[model samples]
Target: MTKSENTLIRLEAALERILAGEPKRIPKNRKLSIRAVEEEANLGNGSCHYYSEFSSKVRILKSKQRSSSSQQEADTGFTDFLKSKAANEKRIKEKYRSENVELKKTIQQLAAEHHLFNELIRRLKTQSKQLEVENKELNVALENTRDELTQLKRERIFKLNKK
Candidate 1:
């Protein structure tokens, strides 16, 4: 129809294309500004200010974009929270696994030490029994020798008295 109307249509189309490509590369909650739309449309400076309809259309588009972007930001924030939570859980599980492995090694080492100590105790008990037997035999021999000495002293006294 008119030249200005044709230019406005081009601006709208450019804005639509920019928004369409937003999910791939754009940051969260980003709305197109008048300057940005104008640049995409290849329009000269202050062209939007010159157009009364341009201002209203840009306002409506910005409002609609803002509402949708708010929802998108909320969804992205929730997704980020979930990812962080999962990562934290994974770290905790790994730490517990590492601690469990260390505990198992400690238990195994203690078991080995216990076995060694038990064998040492058994050997000591056997040695103690052998020593006890030897001590009893020595005590019996000493008693027999003491009795023989007493008998010899008695005989010596009796011969002296007779003389």
Candidate 2:
């Protein structure tokens, strides 16, 4: 046989082996594809694309496999499990998203409250300093008044003794 004929034959055998899940050159249970077939046949990449008829056949076989597998999954109730799992995941994602939004609002409120408290503390400190200055002034004035009273009392006592 010609080299082209030999290549076509190898390609056909590879395609069958892959579809039957009995690949020799490649690992078993690999997904069916032109590249997989090429590897299974020990042929170079893009070898199968040169033959349009083979490419079409591969497409038809892959579609059939997909349909059959999907039907089997439905029969085994696996499709239902996957659907429920996906729904649960979606619900959990939405719950977390809403919680994240609430947490952000709480953080914003706390930040505002923190700013208010800091401002109040600053005002209190200023008032305390003013009060301290006023207290010191009052103490100095009271000491001067006591000294004047003592001098007046001494002058009165001396005047009475001389009389």
Candidate 3:
């Protein structure tokens, strides 16, 4: 057979092997690179690059794989985004929980301060009332002393007039 005919036969056989799941005839990783095709066809390393028909066929196969691969990549990206979002939400929730705990503690402290201030005011009011009572008693004693002094002075003046 002519060299071109031989190449065509090898290329057809390679395509059949790829479709038939022949081990090592196709890449195990599901990537149909040009190298894999050339190896399957038992062609020289650069043979497929030289043949326009072979190159076009490789392009067609790769495009087909890419269409399906693109969908899978999109799904993976969405899944990663969801995972990140969930983690961020959890972090925010924990932060808020800690802040809430601190706020509750602060409120308790303020309540204690308020109670102490109220107690102090009550004690001051009681002291003020006691002072008022003492002032009233002192005023009464002073009035009694003044009356006694005036009586003594009148008695002395009457005795002197009699003498």
Candidate 4:
């Protein structure tokens, strides 16, 4: 009938969506906070604070939701609760087990790459040392060639002067 009424209805719907794990505007894993409700309802931030009554109602709903699962279990029976809990734990255990296997594969791949790189480095170092030795021997040969050329020039000059 009024703007306030419309906003309140929207907020209530958003809270229901969140509680039912079917939120539209906000993420499913978002906690039951005023801000989350506001976002879920597509309202501005702190909109809930504008209505004190609505804010209090939201708080109450949050507290109830926290213990709702246990309350449901109590209403039903311990057997059902235990079965559900065991199933949940089994799922979690399997998730972690698969993750561990993937991590071990990644580590093995990395180790193999490291070993290959180390071998490459060793071969490169050996080639580098061999090149250095060859370079030094070439330099010595160059110096010897220069000395012989200088002697030959001096002898030619002495013969020309005598002529």
Q: Tell me the tens digit of each residue's lDDT in model 1 across 1-163.
A: 9998899887777667677864323332456777777777788767787777777888887888788888899899999999999999999999999999999999999999999999999999999999999999989999999999999999999999999
Lowest lDDT sum, 10 consecutive residues, model 1, at 22-31
Model 4, global lDDT = 0.91
Candidate 4: lDDT of 114? 100
Model 1: how far residue 126 lies from native, Å: 1.4
* TM-score result, candidate 4: 0.45
Candidate 4's C-alpha runs over 4 A off are: 1-85, 154-163
Clashing pairs in 3: none
Instruction: Tell me the TM-score of each prediction against the true structure.
Output: 0.56, 0.49, 0.62, 0.45
What is the C-alpha local distance difference test score of candidate 1? 0.82
Question: What are the lDDT scores of the predictions, listed in order?
Answer: 0.82, 0.90, 0.82, 0.91
Cα error, residue 28 of model 3, in Å, equals 2.4
Better of 1 and 2 by TM-score: 1
The alpha-carbon lDDT assigned to residue 78 of candidate 3 equals 93
List candidate 1 stretches off by more than 4 Å. 1-67, 157-163
Give the root-mean-square deviation of each candidate in angstroms.
5.9, 11.4, 4.9, 19.4
> Which pairs of residues collide in model 2?
none
lDDT of 3 by residue, 5-29 (tens): 7887787677667756683555655
Give candidate 3 regions above 4 Å deviation. Answer: 1-6, 16-27, 49-51, 132-163
| Highest TM-score scorer | 3
lDDT of 2 by residue, 8-110 (tens): 9999998888777788999997878888889988999998898999989988888888899889978779768888999999999999999999999999999
